[model samples]
Target chain A: MPKDSALPSRNGAASPGKEPRTARGRETLRRLLDAAAAEFGERGFHEASISGITRRAGTALGSFYTYFDSKDSIFSALVTHMSQSVAAAAAAAVAPGSTGVRREREALAGFLAFARQHKELYRIIDEAEFADPDAYRAHYMGTAKRIAARFDESVAAGTMSPGDNEVRAWAAMGMNVFLGLRFGVWGEEREPDDVAAEAERLLRDGLGPRG
Target chain B: MPKDSALPSRNGAASPGKEPRTARGRETLRRLLDAAAAEFGERGFHEASISGITRRAGTALGSFYTYFDSKDSIFSALVTHMSQSVAAAAAAAVAPGSTGVRREREALAGFLAFARQHKELYRIIDEAEFADPDAYRAHYMGTAKRIAARFDESVAAGTMSPGDNEVRAWAAMGMNVFLGLRFGVWGEEREPDDVAAEAERLLRDGLGPRG
Candidate 1:
């Protein structure tokens, strides 16, 4: 049977796979998230209408309800998507054996590259962060924890100074947040590489092992 | 004959003093600007209604127009009020003979303290920066010139190293924008002192002389 065969995939019980069902569901979700992101970014979290999102995605308005209970629910989903994507790329920026400076550069570079690609996503996150503080705090604290672990590793290896890890963590988080605001969020015309380099330079001088 | 007169006996020029203005005009302008700042800050620049502002200030709708032509005019007037107040404080913070690190520290401290006292006004500035990028850029660049001048003076006196004054000026600007968004606009529960200290630490490290 051809791999493209729909019937075998439909009845593909050998692997118990749900191909078509999963494909359409995932595609619907992808479209909704993308559309919601654009809508929320432009109209703001509170102002953007669900009907507008559905229209933008060319999906039935009812379909939006199937995926998201409310606009805030869609916002939560976007945060999850952004968090997961940041986590995946974060590991590359801080592999087990990298030095503190090397990891700092990679992390800054990773974030700038990610931010450049998802400029609108960053906008959504920023607007969400402003419109509702507690909700965004949850999103922020979770992401900060992931980056904080990298800071911890640097301290453990003596590649970075031993300071209050929590304070240092927040500072590190601020650095990334500010970097994104400068280049991506604020619509400033700066090259991502230049920003990453500047961030890396600052981190090395500021947080590297204190002699 | 009375000191309380609208035209207080002034150091009159040889020519009759210019058409006398009452303190009432100044008082009306103050109330109008404050009311607009509060309304715009809370409801957002785009969503705020002019009627709401006049009502809040205990003035008739017509009175609002008497003080300002339109919402855009009110915004222009408020922006001028805000930029001048904050810029003067920042300029004082980085005045000549001030240590570079200390100057930056005081500036951030002054800003956060100002925000802590007038949360509404700060939010108005923050929201406007996002909603109206052109106005924000003009405001930001205006401040950046001051910072650059301070940095240039430091270099001339051999108090600070010469580098990209323009780039460093921008970094200074970005630092304030990010911190304002995080601490001021978003209203995180952290103390103003703590936020200011953390920000100052970052700037001192980020913009110090290149080794």
Candidate 2:
């Protein structure tokens, strides 16, 4: 699958209505998204407001209306943006010619780094489960599909045993998400590379088929 | 470790104030928790109300006050209650002489069944991340510790390889959690055993340490 295909849509500006026509408009939309992350991360959905987002973006209130019609729409858009950001970070980390295990490890390491920098990534995406149920489901489903695609490539390359890629993909995604929450968002007690290395081992060689 | 040690505390009634004194009182508290699960599950934290919980529970408003001081306290208690419920379910599913991998598979199966039965589990626990951060952290930490303890047993028994149990435990927990969400909460298209089997395979023998 192409890299951009993994990322969710960017036509988040008011969905059916406003789709940022100019390059400057896209920049403004980007600023609004960054501000939304901060606002939602701090205040959460119920307490979060459009004015709060615009204020953080340093844009006029009119600029906010120019894009999003309401707080819910922008929050939904923000969830998609953050989801894409996660995929983009992982995609950027993995180089060509890496093995399946190596790619999985790199994806995790990139995610950890991203989580550490954007500590709010967990809070925002998690809140989407309640704030925007469809967006939340789409975020996880999209991620699992990407992981499954990687598994397919690995299996095709004869590096990974051909089995149920869907199960493995979900399992891999879960492991990464929790590890990120524990080591990345919770604290930096363990280095990201170290944590990823240990996980890589587990992925490459499980506990045992031995007695 | 003793089984009870695996289970977290249940002093959830009224943190600083009262504890249920009699069997009837405990039953009432349980009823309140079940009702809170339904109310919070359907309406979420912001929309859920005291009266709604009481109404669903079929108990007097005074009964709610008997155990919990406010909506926040009940919600906190509910999160703790759900955490314990999960632990109890997993513990019940694990047989005494099962191998580490077997026990882990059983745990996942148990959790999947629990999630299917209590579809609100994801919502309640996910919501706690925002509503009650401490309880949310406690839930995961307690679960990881339990899994780590199981790892210790497995290593001692010579059934599994010796490695970073903490990392492995978290990875295992994450895999089970996501699998539960996908198979349990999302759909009934897959059977719990088949899902657990695939996960068990991943846990026992990873993608490939060979070719």
Candidate 3:
């Protein structure tokens, strides 16, 4: 008997509300994604092959096709997974349920922690995005917009000024970007937490805004 | 027949230390370097091929080898060439001959102009240095030190303040990096010069240590 795919099979008996039935099916999907991430991280998206992924996952070539149509699908899935993880970490950092300055510190610390843990994935995502213009726009601008919304909220309160929240948001995040570019992406030997703390200070006071 | 190459021949005469004996030879070398910049900009160091470079220069592969030993040599040459250009721009931005906020504005504008004009080479050099950790540390660190010195001078004169010139310098340049990333790198639709001006406003005032 053929195994059912958890990805909403092209032909299905269940409605949209129905769920994936088999635990084995879910486990297989997870293994495939994990293996794909490893392979993509090791040998960039272009250089990685289907056989390499299947071999790493210990699954048959035919089995790989059952869940996804192509390698691009795997990449799309990886981006979605990583984006959600980052978003969740960000959400956990700040909330109406918490204090202000403490939440800011938590947010910065949480991001650095995540970056430290997923160095390969971080590199892969950067490489993949810049290698194609369309992907770069979609991924980066989408994140910028989401982050800008929070920056706008800060502006709504007296925390930040109302002069182009987008630019300031980019500026704030840009510090983190260069930090990642140097430390995370380049594999430079420096304390990320230290860099994050320094960046936090820069964001809080700017270059010399309050002196 | 070996014909002629880019570098000066051993048989050629020179006055102490000088360039090519023949004007043609000097132009050939300049053309080769320019071609290498464009080619490397188009395809990053690893992805670009030497044969393609020679073709772009309208010269023979032997001509390339004559000036440089191999692809690695060409890469090194390209890096040195771009480094000098960026350094010159940085120097022009903060000329040894001048001092004050006006000079700072000019310096920033000069650097932004260079980046806008030479987008591809910028990416190539950036990625190249990133791939090689120690490639440009002295250069970047030295530039940072110079800017910090300027900030320190302003503070000592009571034009600025005593709060961490190092942080201020980084934040200033950090604005340039982010503006470049947003306006140029990500293919965002905005005028670079205008964005540079706005960024300058942010650096000089936006985060100006307001009370």
- In terms of DockQ, the best-performing candidate is 2
List residue ranges in candidate 3 displaced over 4 A.
A1-23, A95-106, A183-194, A209-211, B1-26, B43-47, B95-106, B126-174, B185-193, B204-211
| Chain B alone, TM-score, model 1 | 0.77
Candidate 3 local lDDT, A1-211, one digit each (tens)? 2355433322132223222346665566667777877888788776888899889999999767766677776666666556556656766756555332334445656666666677665656655543544544566576667667766666565565456667765665555554555555555476666665655555554333233
Instruction: Quote model 3's TM-score.
Output: 0.75
Model 2 / residue A93 / CA error / Å: 0.7
**Candidate 1 per-residue C-alpha lDDT over B1-211 given as tens digits, one digit per residue, 9 for 90 to 100:** 3354432212111112221245565456567677877888778777788898888888888767665667776776566567766776665555566755567667876776666666776556655555655666677667878877876876676655555565556556665654654566556577767776766565555422234
Q: lDDT at B158 for candidate 1?
A: 60
Each prediction's DockQ against the real complex: 0.13, 0.71, 0.23
| Candidate 2 residue-wise lDDT at B197 | 95
Best candidate according to lDDT = 2
What C-alpha lDDT do the candidate models reach, one value each? 0.63, 0.88, 0.60
Candidate 2: list runs displaced more than 4 Å.
A1-14, A209-211, B1-15, B209-211
- Clash count (model 3, backbone only): 5
Pairwise DockQ winner, candidates 1 and 3: 3
**TM values, all candidates:** 0.75, 0.94, 0.75
How should the candidates be ordered by DockQ, best one leading? Answer: 2, 3, 1
lDDT of 3 at A99: 34
Docking class of 1: incorrect
True contacts kept of each: 0.08, 0.78, 0.13
lDDT of 2 at B206: 89
